[model samples]
Target chain A: MSWLLTLLAPILGGFLYGIERKLTARMQSRKGPPILQPFFDLFKLADKRPMVVHSYHAFMGIIHFVAAWVALSVLFFGGDLLVAIFFHLLSTSLLIVAGYSVKSTYSRLGATRELIAIAALEPILILTAISFYLHTGSFEVSKILTAPTSIFTSVLGFLALLIALPGLLKKSPFDAAEAHQEIVGGVEIEFSGFFYDTVYAAKWLDMLFVFTLVFLFGGSSFVVGGALAVFAFFVVLLADNSTARVRYCDMVRLLYSLAFVLAGANIILGVVL
Target chain B: MKKTIHIPIGSQHISLLEPVRFSFECENETIIKVEADVGYVHRGVELACTTKFKFKQVGYVVARVCGLCAIVHSTCYTLGIEELMGIEVPKRASYLRLIANELDRIHSHLLCLSHTAENAGYEALFMRIMKDRELVMEVQEAMTGNRIQFDYVSIGGVNKDMNSELEGVIRNKLGLLHQKVAEIKELFDNNWSLSLKYKNVGVITKEMAYRSSLLGPIARASGVNFDVRNDSDYLPYSELGFKSITMEGGDIHSRNMVRLFELFESIRLIETALDGMPEGEIAAKVRGTPEGESYMRVEAPRGECFYYLKASKGQYLDRVRIKTPTFGSVPGMIEALKGSNYADVPAIIASFDPCLSCTAR
Candidate 1:
């Protein structure tokens, strides 16, 4: 069952992305595209002839998607939280390299911002994992699930994760890395055809990956996990709608001063009491 | 040591409404040098006005210079010809012209505001403003025949007539639009994150605005206090109680606020004009052909739109020259972009509300 679910992560992520688009449009008072728009996009993208830039650039995109899938699989197979994080980081790193591999200025700029975003966000993910370890007495997801716990015990950590979700998902106010209006989808501008499909699928996978981290807050209870996931999803959607994209410097400053501080405080509290 | 990179926002870019190109020299996302190209959209409309169209038909021809400010173009052209031909425009026609011009300004401002929001990554706010803009659009369609390219102005007078029923429709829609725009104003004024993107991001100081000869909302935001309506007697704006809105911040936020306040002002002007409309003909008979040169300037939504016409009592005019707001404001736009982060480029450009169709006409 775990294997089946882990293999189906991309499909689940695709639907989640489609729902997010629909919800964003409805909030914007627009009759948005259908819920299956992402899938439709995927089909259309896959059908295009692959316009290969360079061998390394195209290879990196496929590897990036594979690495993201592996990261999700590692978590779903009841693996260590730290290893899952490592694979996730690797996926992003590959995409960043692919961005740098291109000569496109927008792609390079997007990569630079994406690197900055990762620097701003990776610390919180590690801290959240450490907070989990401190609470559960184990870094293993399988052990953490069976261990008796609820979201109430680590409310601060939960809040910290919730705050960082927008950055992770590249929503408004923190979406400088992928700001379509300015950099024209940033790193994704240089990608096209089947290679682009891999990158797009990887984005949905990244969404699933981050939400899975949010799901960890539920800890052994399916109801609490699902509810947290749904709530966190809406919170992210609202933040995306109501705010303008901040400058990259402001994004880093805010993530550090707010989400970073909360995550660090949660860790400190875990150690103290 | 400094490492500067070149980035180009081009003639076919996604964010641009018209074809324009900006080549920027950046040192790690801070623009240091800028080169702009605004001529890609030129359709030889000036030359066409002289060669392809007669003096009477030139008003409609110039209207095609820009769809957003079509009335302003036609009005400027017609007023110049009227001055040259010595035609007395009816008071009711002048009032009706004022209302159509103000309505055009309202819709254009709303579009700029919505685009500024979109460029800031606030898609929801963009959509909200666009939805509210439908109110002004409805009133505009009723006033003129079309929604966008409303060909209401002619060589002698306006083509549309104002009635009691139309007046009621305009009043009801503007009232609803006022409330919706107020909510939007509240959001823009108080939304902290939006302020971060808009406030002080694309600043053009008063000195810079003056030095660069900035016009319209961009100039008003910098406290230039130069509105063509206040300077000219072409549109009967004084009788309509016209007042130009200005802000001192001179940033994207200030420009947006100026536009919002101007929306309220435009609504008031339209309502007042409707109330005091004279009971006369909507248009006057076309008299003799235009002779000699006359210059006419009108306050377009973006800024002052100037038209120069020279006629020799012939069917075709001798020459026609158009100066649009966007052309005058480009220097100020470059100045604002010099030291700002590249991320703010779209928002800043949108705030200027560059109408390239007019610029490159």
Candidate 2:
């Protein structure tokens, strides 16, 4: 189970990324590609000779991917839960900085939005974990498992996390970073073939990151965790399909303001109730 | 104190699916000047046509210029060619072509309306409009094999014949389309915010519309009282009794309303054309060459699609000059944006349903 969790980030991340494309296609009334489309896309990209626009991009992409990988591995191996979350958050921030390094206005604008969304949602995520710590007396996933999971405090924290998931999923209303409707591919616009391929893989891994966050509430039961994760994925998809994207400024105000209130409520509830 | 402000919107903007640069000069939020620099997605297909393909192959290539208005370009090209050859398409085939063109117009107009709603941050309305358009797209797929670039119209006649099964499918789908459009029209007509944003944002007066020689709904919105179908007596339009849809405002709101109203008129035309279906060969035989120049005009989704064909003794034409409706509306776009705000630029530009492919090609 431990080893499986360690591999879960990439495998699930890759899988979820593939699913996002399929979901997008379906929303467009197209018959999307098969489930393994992301892997095929990656393989196709890998076969192409790596052409670097900037020498630092190749390294930055690797670092970003590695950061996300380490974070996912920590979460999978039942390491410090807060540490895993922090690393995942760090991966996106580093990736944004890398995205900003490109002079392409498309990527720069996208990175700016990505940074905003991350800043907006990060506190809520941290607060959710903090609430869990307040109840369970530790910041580690192993301690979370051993603690009484039935506390009202944990559920409130879970709800706060759930509320933040859509922002993390980058679904409509919160899809400012990679606003395809406006900025094309955003930070990933100039990346083509292999460089884009790595970023694309990173994006999928990001989805898996959210899925794993949902699965954390599952508390080691494989069936419950897997089912809940899938349900959450579909829920996000439904939300994406139903809503037209909001503007970046509007999205920031909505997501951050809602998150602040929700996190504040969670903290108060965790302490009082 | 007046200060010149240059605001660049789109080469890769979020509001549009394709990229085109617009330089909007503003005093505060009010737009004073607008200049559009198109040709970001130009594939140079027109130049390729002159060098690569034969006369027969050019029609298909021209249709590929725009994914949205494929039928309009193909039909305009073929109509010009047929006139050059002095061969008239059969009555039923012409009517069927009209049906395809009108169906395309409905779907394209719906897409623009939906995009307007989307850009204005009205998602529920956008989704409702899109879902309704899906039914129309289904009808299109049933008629033409594909949805976007329909390879239906060919020189002299259409490529495929619509049998009773296809006709029945079209009728049933059109009936459903009527109901859906009615609901959508109600949604647009009743919305106050939509009215506030669109009503008089881009107003082109009657003289300006005619002076600019604008075609299609853009001219009609300005009370031009011009429709090629009614005036030119081209295709099945001559056979079918067509009514000119004219509006007085010539504003963005009126343009949108004219398009919406025209969709219903197109549905009516398709029904009339289908009911009066004739029995004849869909295609006409064209072997020999034509003599002089021929000028043909058709009502496209945007406006008048003008094709001037000069034929020689050779198999291929001497020269083909197509003045798409969008090219004519460029002046009108600049005119509309003169006193408008910067925020209204997207909505105003979108109101034209500008086909850069058609214009550049």
Candidate 3:
């Protein structure tokens, strides 16, 4: 059952992306694309003529997708949460490298912001894991799932993760890295055709990975996990709709002063109380 | 490695509405120097106005200059032709012209405000404003029988007349628009995220505005009280109670506030005009060809739109020169870009509301 879920992760991610698009459109007071739009986009991107800037750049995109999928697989198969987090980090790092490999200024600027965003976000995820470890007495997802959980015990961690989620998903107020008007999709600018499809699919995997992390906060109860994920999803969507993207420096300042501090406090509380 | 990095935006960019290029020399995210290249959409409009179209037909031709301010272009050109032909447009026609121009101003300002929001990455606000702008659009369509290129203005007077029923329609639509604009104004004033992107981000002082000869909302935001409507008797704006809106700070936020407040003023003017629209023939008789040079100016939605017409009593004019507001405001735009963050470039450009099609044409 775990392996089957692992295999279906990308498909689930696609649906999640589709749903986000539809929800965003509704918030903006317009009739959005169909729920299957992401899949349609994938097929359309796949059908385009493949264009690569260089062998290294093209290769990095494929590796990025694989790393993201592997990260999801680790979580699904109940592997070490730390390993999964690191793999997720690796996936973004690879894309950053690909962005740097190009001559396009927008791509490089995007990659730079993406780097800053992860810097602000990664510590919160790590703290969440540490909080989980304190509760379950293990970092292994397999062990954590078997243990009963309540979000209230690590409520600060959950809130911190909520703060980080918009940055993770590239939503507004935290979406400077992918500000299409300013940087033209940033690191994603140079990618085209099947290469872009790979990057696009990787983004879907990222959605699942983040939401799955939220679900894990619910521990043993899939219903509770699903509910938590849904709740966080709406919060992120609201944030995206109601705010404009901040400057990259402002984003870093906010995530650190607010979110990182909260996450650190959660870890300290977990260790003490 | 160099200390400064060069970035070019435009000629073709996602954020830009028109094809004017801007090259920025930056140290990190701070823009240290700016170079702008305008006139990409040049269609030889002046030449075409002289050679291809007759004096009577040239209003329509110049109306094609910029779709957003189409009526203003035609109005200015028509006024110029009328002055040369010694045609006194009916007082009723002037009142109708004022209403159409104000409606045009409301829609254009909303478009600029929405675009500025979008460039700042507030897509939802952008969408909301665009949806609201449709109110003005419906009113425009009802008034002029067209949505955008309302060739409502002609040589002697307007092409369409207002009736009691149409006056009711105008009042109703603009009434709804007033409420929506108030909500939007509140957002522009109070929204924290919008304030971050807008407040003092692209500041141009009153000195800079006056020195650069900036016009429209861009100038008004800097406290420069120079409005063509207040200075000229081209239309019945004085009788209709039109007052220019201004705000201090000269930043993107101030410009937005100026536009939002101006929308209220525009709505008020239209309402006032409708309440007391003088009854007469919308169109007047055109007797002779335009013989002498007559220069005319109209306050376009962007700013002052000037038309210099030299005719020799023939079908075609000898010379036609159009100076659009965007063309005049380019220097002010460049001035605002310098010393700002690179991330704010798109917002600054959008805030200037530079109509490149009008500039280049």
Candidate 4:
């Protein structure tokens, strides 16, 4: 089952993204692209001529995808939560390195912004893992899955994760790193052909990883986990549609002051009660 | 040992609709110096107006200068010829012209708003505004017999007349568009994240607007109070009770609010013109060739669209000069960009609503 899920995560993530595109289109009063559009785009990208700035940049793309898949598999097999989180972080850092390795200004700018975003978001993710450890008294995902609802006691921690989701997903109000209008495609500006496909698939895997974190809070009920993930997905879509992209500085200020405080409070409560 | 880095945007960029280029000198993410090149779309339409086309056919030639404001170009050029020939357009023609002009304004403003939203990463709002803008485009096609390059304005008057069926279509679509505009205005006013992106970003003061001689919405957003529609008598704007809209902040949000308010005002003007339209001939008879020089200015969707015509009472004119609003506002745009974050470059450029074709022509 874990092997099957490991193989299926990217395909399923693409389908979810396709559905998101469709929903966004309907909300905007237009008939959106077909649901299989992401797959079509990926295949089209695969057929293009491969271009790279350097050997390391090309290698890093493959490494990033592999690391993301490893992170997903760890979650699927119910391995240690901290290990999966660290692998996820590794995947992102590899992509940032790829971005920085390119001499293009857009790529450098995008890499810097991504670094800042990771700085803002990584702490909350670590805190989320800590809260889970506090709840089940174990770092193992399998143990947490068998435990009763963590939401009842760790509601504040869940809220913090929910607030951080947009930044993690790089949706609007927090999508400053890839602001297509400002820096063009930013980190992805220098990528093309098969190299781009790897980066694109890695994005899908990352989305799956974050939503899975949301699912972890459901604790023994698949229905609650699925519901929470769906709810968060819709909220992110609504936000992406209605708001403008905030500056990177404002984004950091918001995550630290609000989301960090929520997670810190939740951790303090778990220690006390 | 310099800390500033140069970032080039455009010539070919995803955010830019036209092929204009800008080179920004940045320290960290803050822009320290800005340089703009706006000659990419120049097709020498001014030269074509005087050489390739006769005085009577120059109206259609000038209309090709910019697709977004095609009607304003034709109208301004035709009005200039009318002034030279002393041809008096009928009341009904003026009213029809007014309606077409405002409809053009509605669609242009909506396009600018949609573009600004898209640049801000609000893709849904961009699509929504574009979907609604189709309502006005349909009305325009019905009245002018074309969607984009409508040869609606001729030397003496308008080419097509609005019928009762077209009138009904215009009214129904305008009503729907009014409600949608209201919703969009509310969204712009209340959405917190949108406010964060727009409220203090790319600020241009009233003093800067004056020094730059900014016209249209960019100027109006900065409290400049200079709209060609209110300041000139080239059209029946005074008769139609036109009131120019202005805002205080001169930021992206202020510019958007100014556009929204002007949209409502345009709808009201169109409705009034339709209700009070008199029955008369659409076109007046043209006599001799334009003998003397005449200068005409009309309020285009962007700002003042100026045309200077010098005729020698012959088939061809000696000169035809066009000074577009975007050209006038480029300095103001550069002023707004200085000291702003590099991330806000696209948003600030969109807010100024720079029409490159208009400028380059």
Cα lDDT, all candidates: 0.91, 0.76, 0.91, 0.91
Model 3 Cα lDDT, one tens digit per residue, B1-361 = 8888888898899999989999999888899999999969889999999888777788889999999999999999888888898998998899888888989998999999999999999999999999999988998999899999999998788887878898888888888888999999999899999999999999999999999999988899999998999999999888767778888888899899988888888888888887787887877898988889987898888899999989897898999999999999999888899999999999999998989999999
TM-score of chain A of each: 0.98, 0.90, 0.98, 0.98
How do all models score by TM-score? 0.99, 0.73, 0.99, 0.98
Index of the highest-lDDT prediction: 3
DockQ of 4: 0.81
Pairs with backbone N, CA or C atoms under 3 Å apart (clashes), candidate 3: none
For candidate 2, lDDT tens digit of each residue in B1-361? 5486566678767776677777777675477878887767767765666567777888898888778888988898888777777787887678778889989988989998887776654555676788889888999998888888898998888878889999989999889989988877876777655665677777899999888777888899999988877878676676678887889999888887888898898899999988888889888887776657888878788778887767676656567677778878888888887887554566777788877777766
Model 4 residue A205 distance off true place after TM-score fit, in angstroms: 0.4
Ranking by TM-score: 3, 1, 4, 2
RMSD of each: 1.1, 6.3, 0.9, 1.2
Q: Is candidate 3 or candidate 4 better by TM-score?
A: 3
Q: Which residue pairs come into collision in candidate 2? A: A182-B14, B215-B303, B216-B303, B216-B304
Cα error of candidate 4 at position A131, Å: 0.7
Candidate 1 clashes: the total is 0
- Report the Cα lDDT for candidate 4: 0.91
- Window of ten residues with lowest summed lDDT in model 3 chain A: A143-152
**Clash numbers, per candidate:** 0, 4, 0, 0
Give candidate 2 misplaced runs (Cα > 4 Å). A1-4, A19-30, A77-81, A150-160, A190-197, A218-228, B1-35, B38-97, B107-166, B176-261, B276-296, B308-320, B331-352
Q: Candidate 1 — which pairs collide?
A: none
